[model samples]
Target: MANFKLTISDKKGKSQSKELKDKEANVLVGMHVGNEVDATIVGLAGKLKITGGSDKSGIPMRGDVYGSARKKVLLSKGIGLKNAEKGQRRRRLIRGSTISEEIYQINCAYDGELKIEEAPKEEEKKA
Candidate 1:
């Protein structure tokens, strides 16, 4: 069983922290630090991009494409490969191992606007 800690902050300096169990943590399997994800906190939904985090082994974790080995080659190619193919290649290069026992400390920022709507009040009955 793995646990992940998430620290989420909004543009207005408001922040929230929470923890996720194994099942919930799996949703972030492919996502790395600095990656943006849609999240809901206390009924307020928005987008959040991870800022910093660490693995179970205490190793700092970062986004897949942040400091990749193949980044240079991929970016150097002068549009040789199709967009889809390029994307596939990039995924393969940055994907993490499945067997790693890493619990990430994700710091994310809310990117989307949180909108709350109030129901209109009904008029009082006339005498």
Candidate 2:
């Protein structure tokens, strides 16, 4: 079963993290960066857009790249490289845009109002 840690961000810049397992996580598999996810599946009411993600090994996903495999691409500035010269290019390891079972962290942008209902606590349930 696939497990994923989702980092959802809103227009206000506030972000929240959610952990999904099994079926919930499976819904995200095969989705690529720039794809829209069903907010209902993740307990949200707005639209969730996949921006980027990283694997368990910390390799970042790049939208320009295809498939779910990792590759060493020469970059001047982008996800893989933070500090770059005006005209500098270097080979860096980057994962493809597609989400796979190996991906652990997913970054998303949310649009629309968020209304998450809290689940009842164990004590409340017992009472």
Q: Positional deviation of 71 in candidate 2, in angstroms?
A: 0.5
Please identify model 1 stretches exceeding 4 Å from their true place. Answer: 41-43, 64-101, 112-127
Residues 9-84 of candidate 2: C-alpha lDDT, one tens digit per residue: 8888778889999998999999999999888877878689999999998999999999999899999997999889
Alpha carbon lDDT of residue 107, candidate 1?
64
The TM-score leader among the candidates is 2
Model 1, residue 38: what's the lDDT?
A: 62
Report the error of model 2 at residue 72, Å: 0.5
| CA deviation > 4 Å runs, candidate 2 | 114-127
Overall lDDT per candidate, in order of appearance = 0.53, 0.91
Backbone Cα, N, C clashes tallied per candidate: 1, 0
Question: What is the C-alpha lDDT profile of model 1 across 5-108, one tens digit per residue?
Answer: 77767787766668877776776665655566668532446677766655554444434344412222333222322355443543222223221236456667
**RMSD in Å for all candidates:** 13.0, 4.6
Q: Score residue 66 of candidate 2 by CA lDDT.
A: 90
